[model samples]
Target: MPPTDGTPSDTDVRASTGKKRIPKACNPCRHSKVKCDEQRPSCTRCQTLKKTCIYVEKPKTAEEQKIEDLEQEVLVLRQQLQTQRDTESSIVVSQPQRLMGQRPPEITSPDSNASLNHSSPTWTSDKPLKRKRSHFRMQKEVAVPDFINEGILSEPQALHYFNSFFEGCDRYVPIFDGSDGFAAVRLRSSLLLNAICAVGCGISGDASVDSRILHVRLKRWLTTVILSTHAQSLETVQALLVMACWMPERSLILAIATRMAVELQLDDAFDRLVNLSISRPDTPETHILMKSARTWFLLLNLEQILQVDAGNLVDLRIKGVRRCRTLLNRPFSSRLDARLFSQVELNRLRAKVNETLTSHSDDLLQAVQEARVDIDVWYQDWKRIMEASPLSESELPSLIANLTVQRHWAEAMAACRAVRATGVHQVEMMSPEAHDMLVIAKEALQNHLYVMLSQPHYLANFRYAMDFVWAKCAFSFLLLLKLTILLPDVARQDLLGQGRALLNELTKSSGYGSSKVYLRLLQLTIKKYASRDQTHSGELDAFIPEEFIFEWDFPGLNLFSSPTGWDMLFDQYMIGDDLFVGMDI
Candidate 1:
């Protein structure tokens, strides 16, 4: 079957490449790029395609691969030679004569990958120090998603923890803008992300992250951020507010944040709010402005409370309703915002009342009347807000109600303190501010005790709420003690019984250790007085003990002795001083 001109049979057709006949690939199959398998006869592709298979005997070229192999060999030799040099240098540095006289110190090569800059301490010895690790560890290979910050959390984990914050905490304070860009910016800052997640874990009912570890990390970062030159970010201020609300032992942080906020002029940003047309609700720029505004207000909200309780003059004196109404008319007027506005106003008045009480003016009566007028106006405005744009009774609203009642009772107590002094046993003969003090103090003290004793479970709120309520309760008890004999028979016995019950409950309760001490003081004082009064001739004849000195705690603080006009320093020192040293603000 061979062709006439010495050609091979049909199976050998189309198999030539240049001068060589191809053996491994059939010409047709090789052109189509399928496997030829180099079988003795026909390969699978050649058989399937019914084409000719050819064989070539020339060797293929491997020059480029040979050069790559040589390069790799040289690199390995260089590394080995460098390592040998390092070993020799180390050996020379640690001669046996040097080792014989004293113990040898561990020598580390400069090329070692151990962390040299980490502040976590390392104990140097013959053995490596062991470390205890819990759930979190830094995986150097893991990277955050493009928008997220570098380190500690992968994309999925960051998303998972952020949801906890949105669900639990954001309901009360709607500060975040909640857009995609906002989220990206939020996750991009490592300092802010740690703080936000710490607060989230602290509040989250279902969260498994160890909140204490994250909280400790936040405090460490806070030291670097707060005192740094770049501490002007609004999110940083917001995180501070969150910590001030939820964290225990926040006195130092709270003071630093307040000073930083004022230095940054966050309070002044309120006046420059853009018009609604310029700050459209959906725009990114508007969200930035709104967040700034909210940050300013939030600082005011927190600082007002702290300043009042700390016996400092109000740093923020903006009482005009027109500005808040202007803001409300623009892009921010939810019920939550309205309620916060009301509270900010109310707390400012509280600061003024606090100023009057702590102001040791020679004209004390004049100061009291001025403070009383301001307080009456504050109450009127609160009533106005309630009737006009009343918020629904959410959990925060109920807490605000409790705060209002405490403020009312506190103002009454302060007003009576300006008028008179009397022994604990003597009040009925002349009723000046003396009688009013007993009545006001008794209501605040007696009612708080009875209600708390009856419920016994209301102390389980976040630390902010419980701190406020307990302080009010303690102040009430101390006021009644100052005029214990002046109290109605019913009030005295009720406090005695309820105080004992509270002490017993606190023994099993997770309340502050400070509260336990405060209640015991009250209970012990009442026991001594009650036992003596039982053995005395007349109510007035029982001599009040001088040992029963009045001392009580304010909210979130240790016991504050009676005020002696420390607020005057605010006027003297803070008039025009700027504490910003190297900071841009």
Candidate 2:
């Protein structure tokens, strides 16, 4: 009954093991170590362990042991090479420099050459050092172009050629210490001549061929030399900026030059030059250049708004608005001072700019908008003062009020638009102030509207109060809807409604409208109730507020009594109502 499945047992296994014999060698050799297999020059055992494998007698002395060690090292290295060959392809080894018979130069003192004569042992005496004739032979010399060269046919051509003439002289200019004024003056005259030529060509429309050439020459001179050398002087920088402004591609040039002037603390000089140009009566070029400067200034100011730390944003906004006002008020008339105005017609043209301040209110609005502060109250107060002032026009206050409302509406719209523009792509979206405002506004309006629409008992009363409580909401909603249509497909959902359609038709017919607060409210309501359960109250409970179930509207009282009241209602209906509903009452 030994093992039912097999015949062989432990006795047979023991008899087989008793017949095996152990090898009389080192454990490594008996285990068939890879190193022990190396039998040529050295045994694999010694080679694997990196030990000397002397086939003959072992070394008797230290010196002999050292020699044996070196031999073993060589053998091990050769074995390594063989192993590497088995694993990887062989690489071509470069011959050593020593084997090529080339000796590298020795380090010597520089003065050693001067002290050692050709006859000395350290020197090569075989050849007498022929007096080392100057190795500083001039290569091909480039001729400098003369400003008044006879070879050049026209004064413009001569000036154009001379612009590059001083280019080589840049190396000699003491740019760091300060420019050599005399040298700069000569250079300036040459450049100025070229600029004058280009202007002349532009004026005559005949020098068109050389005008571009002159412009390039002048630009190179200003950017490379004049601006670089005399950058300390705002006047010089302004002049360069002015010159660059004359070219078709002026914005980039003006930006660079203005930034340079700003960095150099020559803002006053820059402003002065701009003011002079703007104030110039006779020069159209100067007037246009001033506008370019103003644009640059606006850009700088806009950049500063982003960097604003702790300051009254209201004050900053007022300052910005005032600055724009001042710019608009600056006389553009050519009739008064010919130096201040470009021409008689331009001075006559200046009469039209009395209304420029009104148009520039957009710029003021833009600045205020960027500040992200509430200016509605301030704007209202200012409007009153502006209306009462003899200098202010009758339409100005209404215009300002309209702009202020638009600004607020735009801010809210920007938030909603941002969500569609950004987040829908499965990426993390930055929740900006605008986005938060829209979210709060939308949610509040939506929640309130859903309550109002869902309650059948309040529908009659709601309609009665809708005209007063929801007018503002209706106006804002309409405005928002109009803006939403301008947005891409993804954000159009936020602008949905019958109110929007009604307003659209109205706007088309009457050519005027109010805000879209009400429209957004209606959309929010639809969004809320559309998801509710018609069969059960469970889903509806989540959207409809608990307070909405109770009859809370008080006639002739504040319509915004509901916790989620007319603010939400007006956002949707553009009307204010005096219906008060208290939880306790």
Candidate that would win on lDDT: 1
TM-score of 2: 0.24
- Candidate with top TM-score is 1
Backbone clash total, candidate 2: 53
TM-score of each: 0.52, 0.24
lDDT of candidate 1 at residue 539, scale 0 to 100: 27
Query: Could you give the C-alpha RMSD of every candidate to the true structure, in order shown?
Result: 27.4, 28.2
Residue 212, model 2: Cα distance from true site in angstroms: 3.6
- Tens-digit per-residue lDDT, 137-168, candidate 1: 64333221221343545556556656756653
- What's the number of clashes in each of the models? 5, 53
Assess each prediction's global lDDT (C-alpha) against the native.
Answer: 0.50, 0.34
- Clash-forming residue pairs, model 1: 22-54, 22-55, 23-54, 23-55, 23-56
What is residue 62's positional error in candidate 1, in angstroms?
76
